[model samples]
Target chain A: MNINRNNYEAYFISYIENELNNTQRKAVEDFVAMNPDLKNELELFGATKLEADEKIIFADKESLLQKNSTKIIAWKWNINVWASAAILLLLLGVGWWMMNQSAVKSHQFSEEKINVKSDSVKSSELRIRNSELIKTEKHYLAKNNFAKTKRVENKNFNAKIILPETIDTAELPNSWTSRKKWNEEHEIHVVQEIKPEEILQVQKNVAEIDTIKAVAQNAISVPPTKKTEEKMIAQIPFKTSKNERQILKMLAWASSKVLGKETNNGNFDVSIGFAEISHKQALQDN
Target chain B: MTINDYNFCVTAYADHLFRFIFKHTQHEENARDVVQNAFEILWKKRDEVEMEKAKSFLFSVAYKNKIDQFRKQSKVNLVDEFSAQTKIINEHKSGLKDALEKALNTLPDIQKSCVLLRDYEGYDYKEIGEILNLNESQVKVYIFRARQSLKNYLVSIETVL
Candidate 1:
């Protein structure tokens, strides 16, 4: 209660910091409560102390705050970006599933078909004709029971027959309907021409006709025309079983369908005949 | 806390927090920066920050930011120089503003900060300790030292005049 400026420094410092024990604090509080002059001195000291603790404001503060603010903003931006990425992934998954469903539906609706070209059908037809020719030659020789005669031709002989350059394209009645029909049924491949032995035997038959003419049995008789000879040769039987004939017709129909065209055209004549390859063997073996 | 709560905290505490930072760093711009950053951090963590602890939390952030700034500068002499200029101003008072300003600057950075929180912001020693990352005893010592320093400067003025 009777405190003076001389001792105030030590006591004031301890008092403000609450360093005083309970009794000391109580004494100071009671003294201030009773004495206005003492209280006023304390208040002045407190005000002056506050004034003395002033701070100077410097210019660098703004830049520091700006740097700190920038850091805080960057952290916020990262959070937003992560959220956006998660949303994007979810959308992509949905879109992918939708596309897969449509693709599967389209695949189910489609059909697979193979188209055979027209050229292949034509080639198969040619093959059938050749096989028929070989079969006819075999049958003819077997039916006659002819001796397997070999006519040895003299290559040096001047009597070699010359074939005609061209044949007339005459429309013949379809005498070979069954042959044509048989050919239409099968997938055909052309066989090679008859052997030299067959050609020699034909030449021998011609020589015999010449000899008979020289003996004067028929003075007016003429050499057979190439067309007539070809017709006679084609008359040889190419016997096919009923089942074989049916299969050949089906193959021909299939081939025609592949070409997208009809096989039997009245304008087109098939006159090429079958030639035996081994007449001597056929005649002897039969 | 919502946006409104965040704004309220900022409006209530920004200037006081800036003053504390300014007292320590002696730079108004750096003080503003430290306070703003502290508020921004609070805003970002609004949900986690409690209203009762908001003041201390903000001061704690600002205090740490100031320390980091000083450390980055990498020269103890700079801090000492700042302290010396502050001491000189406190001793020589040309005007009331000059005297008060210098008096505030005279305290060491930690003491200055403690005094600001105590007198200007009206925070207790426990709150000061939490903000400055000091123990309660350390906070008490800082505030005590700061007040003593200010009293001596004011007494010197009275004696000289």
Candidate 2:
């Protein structure tokens, strides 16, 4: 555009604003020179252009700097999580089954370590007075006293007096002959009040029971202490079912046969009134 | 924009933003607040802003914040201007620099922001227009009127001297 009396001021602003080229700037200078009366106003206009203030800076740019390295993560859901859970559960189940299998194998290799601590008396007896058990087993399985042992196959049979080889419970009959079957038969809950030592002693002497009817019959001839026996019978615990009573009595008599000293003395009161069933009587008689 | 781009805006434009806001607010804390507010808004909307527009966005926000601040405290502004002039008259023996500064303060806020953004940032008229939400011609007019006002202020001071 042309600089004129009317438009010269716009030219002047552009000139001072450094918006003008050299030709336009020179034209503005020439026009201003031609107008000396407007010179002071032009100088004031030039002076209005403010200088940059270098000193006023933002003091703490540090506060604006974010230190968190948080990534902008768009939420992505895993639809396969159920599959992963199922796989994890499968692994856990397999681990549990393996552990259970190993536990059974270890069970078969194990047996109770029988302790044979004797009571004050040399001949220790463990008998149950549960007459009900006696009647049932005596009628049915009692004839097998000679076979009083489906468990004769157990290594514990030939075991010596002290610290015998453990009898493998697996070899025992499926009947309540094994202690495990004893436990499994939930029908009975006989808490043995006898020192477990007395039971262990009976267990020890049980090995001496000769599977001969001749020796067993001789034991029956050893005169019975009917008076002492009656007193001991009063001490018996609850009357058991026939099978459990028969088992307890058989164990007691096997122990008695080996402790011949106490029996010969006739001092064997067997006062604790436990049992000696037809199984052992049959074994001793055999 | 990325975080690095945002931080670059901070390093590059913080001083200019501060100086521009400071000229209008005339108080360091108030200017810093305006400047900080601008940067905070920029950071919050970082994803929406472009790197090329960061400086313009910051100055635009700062200018609006300063105007808002002024509007909020407008009741006291006249009293402040009167006191400023009184202080200027009392300190009349100071140089043209002080006179020019006082005179700059005397101009309306729009002229002050326009002229200062022009000088301090060396922004072209379109750039200033973009920051102030004015057209290029409006920016030019505001700058011209601001210069005329400043020149008149200088003339008054010269006659007094």
Candidate 3:
């Protein structure tokens, strides 16, 4: 644009602002030189440019600086401490797993196969059908020629456990609901039939044994504290077949013990099909 | 930016930053507070900000802080005071430098910012716009108006002298 009087103010402002190129700057300079009257206006424009004062320093420059933060980032733990903590955590984890497994195994008690074998001597079978353990299921030997059968009455059971002499593994119920159902339905009756047969004559066959203890009638005492009494069953010498051995194994898995160490002196006069034997019964010497 | 780069900024730009803020606030303490706060924020965000952009980042933060302070105190117009100072200066016939300084003080807040950023920092129009959050045209207009006001003040003083 031409530097005329009307538009000189805009050119002058641009000139002082350093916004004009060399050509525009030289034009404005020449325009002022030609008309000495405009020189005063150019001088006013020049005075408008403010210079930065370097003397005005921020006194505390050190305050604005940041440290490298090396001190706060330091970790005091050694390698041994870290390794010890890791090992402790691992041990705690394994212990918790083992305890959980044991608890899970106990719930599946009824799922184990029942022990069934024929006895040569005339004996009766007892079934405490309630899935829940009976606080008291009396097994007392008669002083005379008698067989006593005590039935623990349980009603409102819907599931029955499948019981037989021999069972197919494939046909066995797999689900816990079905197993729990079987246990609930087949719930009742304890029949102990001990004929004038000796205890030695009876086969050591477990139908659904959790325990077997010899209790004499005259020797009735306080209720046994132990839910499981392994020492109660008389150690009668009886030969076991493959099926019987399997039954013993299932009994061992159930009771955590298969054979009894203790023996009673009195001979039984009746046949017996007993389960959950509590050896806490009184021992009578014949 | 590294701590060294940040420290460098502190040593290099702190004085200019203080000067820029001090001119606007006119309160040395408030200006110092704004500068300190701006540096703290810059240090905190140093990882995100590039080394080249650190200067602009600091000025932007300080500018926003100054605006917040202005809003808290309301628009502090010194027109009456400026006129009184101008009257006193005319009577005394102050030096050109002193007269120009007083003329700069009498400008509008935005005009002062535009002119200070342009002349003090030697920033081009676009850079001024980025720092002050204004368009290039707005910055140019502000600068033009500021220069005109300063020159007019100077001319009147020159006439008196």
lDDT, candidate 3, B1-161, per-residue tens:
99899999998899889888767765556667889999999999989989998888888889976655653442454323332211112234358988887898788888898888888988899988998899999998999899889999999999999
Model 1: per-residue Cα lDDT over A1-286, one tens digit each: 4555466655566676566888887767776676666665455356544532334433233332312356677888987898888899988777656444433332222111001221111001111221221221111111111111111232211111111111111211123442233223221111112233432343243233233223212211123344533333344333444322322232223222222323244121212221111121123224
- lDDT against the true structure, each candidate: 0.45, 0.55, 0.55
Q: Estimate, for each residue in B65-140, the C-alpha lDDT of model 2 and write its tens digit.
A: 5666664553343423423212222234366677788888888888888999888888899999998999999999
DockQ, every prediction: 0.08, 0.25, 0.33
DockQ for candidate 3: 0.33
Q: Candidate 3 lDDT, tens digit per residue, A102-207? A: 4344223322322222110111122223333231223221111121222334521111111221222223233333323322332212111122122222223322
Could you tell me the interface RMSD of model 1? 7.3
Regions of candidate 1 where Cα sits further than 4 Å from its true position: A1-10, A17-26, A29-45, A51-286, B68-97
- Give RMSD to native, each candidate: 25.5, 21.0, 16.6
Higher-scoring candidate on lDDT, 1 or 2: 2
Worst lDDT 10-window in candidate 2 chain A: A138-147
**Docking band of candidate 2:** acceptable
Better of 1 and 2 by DockQ: 2
